[model samples]
Target chain A: MSEFLVLVVPMWVVFTLAAQGTILSGRTGVFNVTQEGVMALGASVGFLVSYKMGSNLVGLLIAFLVGALVGLVLAYMTTQLRLDQFVVGLALFFATTGAAGLLYRQVIGVTMTPPRVDTLPKFEIPLLGDLPLIGDALFVQDYVFYFAVILSLVMFWFLQHTSAGLDFRSVGENPKAADSLGINVTWARTWSTVVGTGLVAVGGAYIPLPFTGIYTDGMIAGRGWLVIALAFLGGWRPLYVVAGAAFFAAMDVLGQKAQVLGLGIPHQFIEMLPFVATLLVMVFALRWARQPAHLGMNYDRESRLVG
Target chain B: MSTMQKSETGPGGSPPVAKPEARGPGILTNIAWTVVPYVASVVLAFFLGGLLIQLMGYNAVDALRAVLTSSFDTSFGMVETLHKWVPIVLCAYAFAIPLATGKFNIGAEGQMLLGATGGAAVGITFSDLPMVVLLPATLVAGVLAGALWAGIAALLLVRFRVNEILSTVLLNFVSFKLIDWVATRVWPDAGAGHPATTPVGDGARLPLLGSAPAMHSGVLLVLALAIFIAVAMRFTPTGFEMRAVGDNLRASMVNGVRTSRLAGAGLVIGGGLGGLAGAIDVAGVHGRMLEGMQSNFLILGIIVGLMARGSMLALPVVAFGIAVLEYGAGTMQLVSAVPVEMVLVIEALILLLLLLSDLVRDRLRSAR
Candidate 1:
């Protein structure tokens, strides 16, 4: 169980960070559907940078910056040009996905064996690490795990407790009203989307660090899409998202470990658990979970429509 | 809302109202207006792609030439492009049909795979059946399976108010595993040395068109489907209602249109077409359901669908263009050592540029 928990924790960080990033932009009315592509780009960039620079930290940072650059384009098109957020996001998704592969192939070339980087080293939390199972599972981890926990808590506090966060969220709920109140709707959206997307890339970057230190195509799988579902399931709340991420991570880890678990069902069916479970959960999640009123809709201040 | 309105008003929108003073120049200019953006976008995308290829240390001119002209240079290339076009166009329909009712069906990949699995199952089970009975059964099974798969998302969207995008996308991952199980466990072909099902009987294969480099009859079927879909979406009342719901959901609801039901139907239909693409591939190309058979059709379909900009008439043409580029991508890689990913990047750039052209045209019109 402790071993399972250890696996689940890192997976949780990926979901939490990605979901939080999604909701961050989502709350600011810039619905970012580029998570899948951005995450792949992040994995590629993160893996490439770490392999070259010999530092995971640098890889993570560069991944964030690269994701931020994509976010900048998304923000410009959706906010300034007032193009459809989903359309622009989808376009960017394709561009980034292709770029991810392009960059990797250009740098690595075709080889019999892919080069690897050292996985992040786990650091024990001194006294806390001495606890039985949970400590080793949760407390004793790499800096990325700690960063994810702290980031989730900080995001929760920032979005729930701060006036700035309220202003930021108002842009998604009612951009005209937010603009009328001098909230700088565009500015709020731009920054949040940039940072939010950066965090998402950081989540992608984290994937290679926890286990395999090499990046491969389709490594993000459908986790990026699941993160979107996670954001919605959690009602775009940071703490709820953290909890939701735990469930997602558990499902993910279980799916990966199904062959070892010796479940009677075929491992393929086991692998389907995360997606099928998410579908089932979504039915119930939508009952209580309410998304930002204007989540995927572009906000036009000059438009006559009420929203 | 504005986005829907803009798409509805774009060149791909409903046919313009005939004016009493309609003349040659007016028609010519209209043709130019429609054609220029597409040409410009493609050219500009190629130029950017060339720069990227050059930077990557490849022969940009040769690569670009290979990408554009490969399909036209040889009979084999033409047949391959048409074969490729079958799935590309069908998948585009899978996407565009749903978009007509304001739902995004991103699960075409899953639907197609399920369709292929469904087709393969029918083909394998009725292996000894005459072609008259088996071929139609295989295709119908595929359509039903695809529809059933998409119906899950539709049911979730309509009954539970779950976001269709999330539901559909998640369903894709589920389909991937489902197909893997089907290939590996249910109908595993041990001799194939890959996770693939046993090949369907001869009766299930699509009839070939020519002596050498023969194209499958599925291409002809899809061509017919393209025409049927174009006419249906443009002239039929149901299509009108679907388009109305997509254009203005509240307005359609106020007018007593069964918007939700139509949206659900659109998704099922889209899924059916997606399934047809899979089934066609099974009957025509692969003869068996295999892992990774879905390829990147989902992405390509979405790209083609978006590029069509809500025009049913434009979808097949755009899909064909994409098919040419896609088929050429392999030749480009062979001739110039440029990665196949460059074409995807170029295709994406074309989509973005085409979208940007809308803004540019809008700006220019307002300035005038």
Candidate 2:
């Protein structure tokens, strides 16, 4: 129905907007594909705190903070220990995934009921919301949507205009040059990933608090990795990244439409379209994308590669 | 990572550090040095693991005591450990072969899954066959499936210059969905009302070893495979060529070692062993291709491979260590009010410490 489209499209855009924040972090060279884990951690923490304090806002803040802390640990290993970034990221994934599943199981064992939450209600600006299609799409949404939109704008300004942004960019592009200039290359990566962690956790917290209204294992699934891929597809630009996310949102919302539209694919295969498309795009497009020269290198002041 | 930097190295501060001869040392000193770098790390991880148990408001000693006893004390526990270790050993050997040949294989899990599926299918389809005929066929089918799966990555790498790591991982996603399809559509087990194949018939079940607890002939096969890999790596011309290619591909090519063939051989053999592990798991543990049962199982293989350090001698020990950790985590969940997330936290800390310690060691050596 048109009503369903009216509802789904806008929410889909907001999800994409949130994913853009993740892509920005990737562009900044954090490479913390463990975003999914951070998100899950935030979801659990948010659920626990919101349940305890009866304050959804507080839960959101806690989720952001906790997710960042987990990122810091990841940053410590990847930045300081000089481990293989991919393996570190994968290990992070393993630990967090198992932890998330176990935590969910312990909390909701054998309980058939989806944990309930009084989700944040939607708000409408008095005048703009009155516009026929555009107004409703833009203005009438939950607090998370507006927050994400504002955050996107702020990030766009910050990444482009700030001195710290220049240092961060230098650290990503050429670590040797950054280090020669006395910029703490490790610190920049660590902080960017920390912020990335917070953003991802915010994404995760949305699930239990406002998105799904309950906790479930593998709920974020590979959306975290998708965010990483989406970042590259967006060319790490904020606006394009959001668009890329919306494209996925459309796929997500339309996933069930395969049956309705008689696309005649297995539900799983249809569901895989967005990810497969992204992977192919990434594989091909990656040949063209210029990476930060030190993208996943672990720098030890003492050790040098013979080559 | 926190080490003083003194970058100057020459007559003022060095002892002709550049020469190949300078790298050698007394036999005892060399052994001591290699052992020293790892000792602190392993000890630190073990200590921290204990500390975490204490931090969880439980007696660390009591928990570790139980774990140690469970892994070693009773014959039943010993058999359980060996039983659990067999698949892990095979999986590590499967991964380590290509890894030694300078290939990164993250698809061990997916390969194992296919092995399980393929072997189960063959076994179930031929359930009317004699036990001797059925069992070996199932395992062989698994090994072939694994090799064939890995062969895709190998073929692409050889022909198209595709990145094997990325391709293998992507293939994992494909395999997972394919698995889901199989569990849901092709081989639904009506009894469980869940995604899984029909229960494998008794003919496919592995024979237990002399009334030992869960110990099967698979462990003996694992031992034989370990000996085979170790001997191959140590003595064979094929292994020397593979090692030469790994050390320096261009140099080895110039020296007339066929790098391509070596790569193909390594990958095929690795995948075959991984397939064997999957087959063993199906025939020995689950008796059916069940969904969710193999989650994190491949990870155990990875951990074992890393800890093995390309040494087959180390594979059994690494596998045993992982089995102890896994069994401990399982036991803790069953017995205590402690959350199973504690196991995840412990594993995370262990990996974190492992990486951190290696970095620290490198830094310390440079400082010296």
lDDT of 2 by residue, A128-206 (tens): 8887766766677778878877777777777778888788877776666677799887888888888777877878778
lDDT of 1 by residue, B238-343 (tens): 9999988887788999999999899999999999999999999999999999999888999999999988878888788889999999999999999998889999
Report the lDDT tens digits of candidate 2 across residue range B256-338.
88788678778778888888888988888788887765566566776666655556666677778877877666566556545
For candidate 2, the TM-score of chain A alone versus the native chain A is 0.87
Best by lDDT: 1
Quote the true-contact fraction of every model: 0.63, 0.21
Candidate 1 is graded, for docking, as medium
lDDT per residue, candidate 1, A84-146, as tens digits? 778778889999999999899999988899999889999998899988879888878999988
| lDDT of model number 2 | 0.69
What shift in Å separates residue B267 of candidate 1 from its native position after superposition?
A: 0.4
Question: Which one wins on DockQ?
Answer: 1
- Which pairs clash in the backbone of model 1? none
Candidate 2, residue B259: Cα displacement in angstroms equals 6.7
**Scoring each candidate complex against the real one, what DockQ results?**
0.60, 0.30
How far out, in Å, is residue B339 in model 2?
A: 2.4
Error of 2 at A299 (Å): 3.8
